[model samples]
Target: MKRVLNVPGIAYGGDYNPEQWPEEVWAEDMRLMREAGVTMVSVGIFSWALLEPAEGEYDFSRMDRILALLQENGIAADLATPTAAPPAWFFRAHPEALPVDRDGRRLSYGSRQTFCPSSPAYRRAALRITRALADRYADHPAVAMWHVHNEYGCHNAECYCDTSAAAFRVWLRNRYEDLAALNHAWGTTFWSQWYYDWDEILPPRATGAVPNPTHQLDWRRFCSDELLSLCTAERDVLREAAPSIPATTNFMVMQNFDALDYWRWAPELDVVSNDHYLMSTDPESEIDIALSGDLMRSLAGGPWLLMEHSTGAVNWQPVNRAKRPGELRRNALAHVARGADGIAYFQWRAAKAGAEQWHSAMLPHTGTDSQIWQDVVRLGADLQALSEVRGSTGTAEVAIVWDWNARWALELPSQPNGELRFQDLVRDWYEPLWRAGIAVDFVRPDADLSSYRLVLAPNLYLVDDTGAANLTAFARRGGTLAVGFHSGAVDENCHVRLGGYPGAFREALGVRSDELFPLLPEETVGLTGEVAPDATGTLWSERVRTEGAQVVASYTDGPLTGRPAVTRHTFGEGTTWYLATRPDPATLGSLLDRIRSEAGVAPVRTTPDGIEAVLRRGPDADYLFLIDHTGRGAEVSVSAAATELLTGKPAEDGSVTVPAGGVAVVREPRE
Candidate 1:
């Protein structure tokens, strides 16, 4: 059975700020919210000025009225602490609160998240504000949950302020226990960079022709940990005041803010909430959105909140373009299909003045007469009609391993292959599976792979002992594995594991890649072998050898021409596929098909080009979300007929034509 939140249907509404507008507009706001079926509204965010007018003095008169207005309207509140954007007075009084950039420049109030996360002044103020908010709203019926500090982090690395430098020294002491251990971990012996005292240590250099990438990476990791502690401080205060209400920090998807390792903080979060914004020029833009949804669902271990996403054009990106008709609903349905408990935009109403003035909102300056308003109302009513699919969770027999620490380490390694990126490899494999209508699990390396029929480890360059053990166990237990180029070469410390590439799993994979051949962007190598399957392109080629495995594909190269480019080995009852070269998308698709047949994995539905579909079944019902990702319409064919849950119409012939940006959620009588 799929897990559900307090509500049985999709939770609607968004970030509302009555503080941003006049009280005369409150009535219209309520009417429009009701029209959109907004049951919840997050409030008190970015209201530090209203909450705290002075150091010791506090004011909640405005907040009290806002809460009363919302409660009277039967709207729940996702209350924020107003600690995210502290007032200028606080920063002026305590200069330590200001953040210093990597370039050693102290930042002023140009944006939110400019406060030093490790600053004592900031922590003290954040605790006070959070405690006050929780205490005041503890018994309020409209209070839904506590939203701690908006977005939590803004990629602030390279803080050399005295406050941060002092904290960094303490952080290093705790991590390495001693100067000697720190030197060894940092490999300081290589550049004669040994540190005699803790004070000699410095934050990673900001700019130079040859910067220490490894130190910069470690510093980034340390900064992330420090910010997490800041969140923990506020969380503890809230927990003390109100034990029942859930607490969460909003995460920006794919942002370089150090907390990419949510597994470390998932325990603290009641529900993982993330802000999703898809920026792509591809017609299949919804795939990027869908991928973000899957990533969020995996992070929370269950259903997560669609905390913040743009309904259309975002003012922040280089290009801000409004979404076409039906695109908003299509994006919303993607989140719902991936097990999101609630869906909300960044703002209910557009800001007239601020950094996000031009960002897309439900209500623009012109008010409810706008097209966006109508779209919101239509989508809201449509969502209400399809409430039965509330708890449907994505089911998949294929799993992909994602490791943030490993990703960070690999990018920061002081070695060859500086261009190696984790997201590139993961996306290369994921898109092919997605196109094939194959649902995949974004799981941890330590996750139990027994349930999955097939597993993919693309650019899994760094694997600890436990991860290696888990992969080996899965292979021995009759699970098919697909690993790509530059995998299993190094451990977490960026050191080669000694025996050979892939260490313990060499026998299981039945292949050993001794050398890595870097290719130029325009370089071409035609792959010709049994497994090529017509895949061709210059997407980073490599040469490999097979011991016990059979050569499936070979690269036509200089000296290594006709060398194994792809190999397959039968291990236990299953098999392992290794790709030495980065195959083109077509070849990867063919490889995916082959693996699906070998593992007996099945797809839910298939379309010509534009349409994407997935079936999620709960204990008593099955829900299908179909999306059209192409510019032109595409026809979808399904096995079972269903009732159009969005429209309550009977679906016939197991087929439906979807126009671009069109979406359908159907519920059928389960067999």
Candidate 2:
């Protein structure tokens, strides 16, 4: 696969808005960029007003100077199309371009991503600006890649305006081909809501009760497609005007922004880039970051780009806490360890004015005298030293299935339980493996499972016949399969599969659920056999019966005491495990340990708590990244004799020490 950027080492630097600063500050900014070892920067983002002050009139003078200065400093440019936030004049000329919320309130145009995606006026303006930028910078020596737009559908994912309604009608007609088919698919006969004409249907607005499940689901899909259409429309412009430059749009996959289906969008873009922000409320933010990186890399099918991260606290979170002394470096290296070819932050300098003034940046308001600036310089040097680590891919023996459709289905109103969340189940399963030094890949349900020894799907609430068949085939081919609660209960249309629960994989799993016994938030159940003695289950439970499976663990005390809480069955050459409830960490770890042993899967290396060991393999060399996420030092067992790329010293005695909040990149020769 072609790499995103043609840089020799890991590309560094971030979004640079030189237009926000004074003219003299531009030269100093370049000097500081060079001093900090910045090699690339994303310019022209959120500069639509400056780029085009009026319709049919354009001004590239400021951007021209910025590009020239960056080239003079030997820095490559990731040029943006500057259409994310249209100027106030464009909206004034076309008031219908603004998006409307589900409550029928028209959103104002003071912020970014305020235009409706389905508006033809918006599309025309976006394409015009894209063509102008591509024509102006396509031949520039500083241009390396084209940033299509900044974070598509970030704020304005779904627009319930008239334009969107009309486009949605077209989308529905294209999908169903006829009104009768649409009625059957949507199950519109319920509640006497049958549609007689295509125009009678509308985007699911706020109703007294839950809207039709299929209607809401289809609307979500349609909104995502609309935004994707906007992206592809501009991408075609760049592809024609600048055939050589690759194009990409930043994805916000960190917080479950499932408006756009990334799996569908991944194939259309030249490279996959993601924007992630830390959840200060969650203590385990590092794990979330790793999860995002792995998911993005999987979407790209190789190394991806960290398009936007933060230098410190952000402006949007409820409580934006600044990073500790070494937290910033640790976070950046974490992404690099997990198949990131490039790392960039949101902004280069702290904004003097604007909505993000409080947001941290590489060059903070304190100038170069602060610890953040010093750390930024040090990180740049570190990235330069470890440039050879670029293009290496992380290896994993286990794959966890994460589906956006399933997540959306699970979050729909009127489910079995109100407290059940898709992310909670995923973290419950992923945390144990992550802490045990076992590498994992976040995969889609239909992704190739032949190379993996084990596959775990948590809360796979929505499954199609193809996905179910794929899982069955994986198990039959000797791959261990583990599935969690509420899986295989429904099809793609949110309609329950007939006959029994876990409908499609019932035979393969050798089990069936007769009833779902959801627990209250404070409820808990005890597990007795073949698990941790003190193990307890919470959040969910199910009354399960075995057809041919053997009971691995049973509930000791609860509503369904003495019932099977976990079961295993041998199918052909492989085994299938079912977890009927959310097990505590110790219990989950014990179960995973058994699965790992059964599949002969081993960790790359062993480390103490707060330290992570990840291996990235290339054609000629294997890179081992040891990161200490704690304030205290930790030790790791290095099985192979390898040279530490950062220190140029050989790791002897099969052991290495990683300082508090430090990283060690070791390269071992591969046969």
Candidate 3:
């Protein structure tokens, strides 16, 4: 995969909609961009209406002038296809392009992403605009990369209209190829839901009883594929027209809204870019940001781009709280520390009128005099000074298996517990590692695990034979493995693994469960053993029977009292640990500490609670990032003697100090 652009420093600046304002303001915008050390700007994202006022009518007068202005100002342009939100006139000409909800209600126009993914009219219009953009900007000096349709599948992931229904049937036919295979995979014999023909299957809609679990799972897969197909279609157009320019579409990573299978989509793009937003309600929002950056970097297999992040507040959230002083710079550096070669925001300047009017920008409503603008300029200078950190990659010895199919299967109805959420389980496992400043990489279940010392598979409810074989081999090869509750219980088709709970890896895990005992919302149970004597377990507990595993922790209360809450078993040369219940933070930390020690997985260097230390290594040098997320000063110990990049001072004693809500970038000599 392509790791960096042809440019020198980290790409700065963000989305610039020059068409939004008058011609006079455009020059001032360019001046401000150069003053702030901006190198790139994404233009014409939502300018479909202005580009093509009517069907078959193309107007590039405004876009041509905008590209020329960027070239004159010495700024690279990430040209967009402008097919995200089609103009109202195109929809009026072909109303069938609009999307429909689960209740069969056709959604009206006015909102963005209103078109159906499977609609031929929408595809035709989108491809036409893409071809035009590629043809015009292929040889333009200002164009650096091609930004495809904006955030595909963000608003319209699934449509329950006739077109979508027909498409779903076709997809199923292609996958199953025969009704007998479909029936066996879906387990239709029990509910008399057998399908004799291809047209019988429908998108899982709101019905009297919950739709078939396998059917719902397949629908989700189909929906993700449909959106991916749309992206690939536009990508093909740009590839044919402008073979030299790289194409990418921003991804909303770790967000709960869209269900697109990014694991499949990541391979098709030249660069992986993500738009991340901070959650104001969560106190540990920094960890969330780190997780997102790490996931994006892993998807790209190297340094990626921070496409869009808010400067302060977002308009869509219920409460748009502004960032504290220095918080924005800290967040931007956090992404850079995790392997982001570029840092960009949603927009350059605040919008005067739009759906995202209240969203914060680099240049806020208060203009250049505002503190936000000052911070933006300072960050720009900092990025320029730290340009040597480009093309570097982070190294991680821990891998966490993240499977979208397992997540989809866990959401099916009639599970042991309805309150169980897949993301919560993942977060529970990741928080401890994040707090310890231990770097982690997110990988698919089928990915190779031979490089990592420790692997965590949390809530891997859906396990195929290949995944089971991989985990078993990893354990036998002396790699430490940890499997969480409700894992390895079902097959790829959401069918039970017949003999016992967690049947696929019962022998590898060295444990078996006859039944799942889900606790009520407020119920709690105590745990007592060598691992965590005073810690408590809540949310879930299972009656476990160990075959060859030794009980590490046992329940002290609840109906399954005296049973094994946590178990450890020695395989050939390594060990596998299993937790049959959800433990509290203290208990989870204790378990992780033991595993970390056993696997020889240590942090880069220990710091205070709110200070984070991350290392990115290149061929010639190593970059160490120290960020203080707390509101007080922190003194951190560096792993080696290095010179701070921001301030050319050497910390030969392996210690440095960071102010409250500040960041420090140090370049260590490569050994």
lDDT of 1 at 433: 80
Q: Write the per-residue lDDT of candidate 1 for residues 1-671, one digit (tens) a residue.
A: 22123543777888999898899989889887987898787898899878998875789998998888888988888888887788888988987678887677778975676788778888888888888888888888888788888776654534667777778889888887998887776777876778899888787656555545456556766777887888788877887787777888788755333454676766678768888876745555666776777777778765788888887788866777788877888888788887777888889999999989999888876777788888888878877876776666778899888887767776774545666677767878888788888887788778888789999887677777788778877987899988876677766555566755545467778987666676766666777876554555354555466778998878765556878878899987779888877788888778878977788888766567657777777777678787877767776665456677776666688766565667777776667
- Model 2 spans > 4 angstroms off: 1-4, 639-641
TM-score of each: 0.94, 0.98, 0.98
lDDT score, candidate 3:
0.88
Kindly give the number of clashing pairs for every candidate.
2, 0, 0
Model 3 lDDT tens row, 1-671: 34235556898989999888899999999899999999998899999999999987999999999999999999999888888999999889989989999888899889899999999999999999989888888899998888888988889988988899999988988998889999999999977899888887778877888789999999999999999998999988998987777888999877674487789999999878889999778777888888888889989888888989999999987898999888899999999999988899989999989898999999999999999999999999999988999989988999988888998899789988898888788889888888888889999888989889999987899989999889878988999999998998888988889878667879888899998899999888999897645788888899999999999999999899999999999987889999888999888987987887799899866888878888898897888898987778687776456888877778878877787789888887876
Residue pairs of candidate 2 with colliding backbone atoms: none
Q: Name the candidate, 1 or 3, with the larger TM-score value.
A: 3
Q: What would you estimate as the lDDT of candidate 1?
A: 0.76
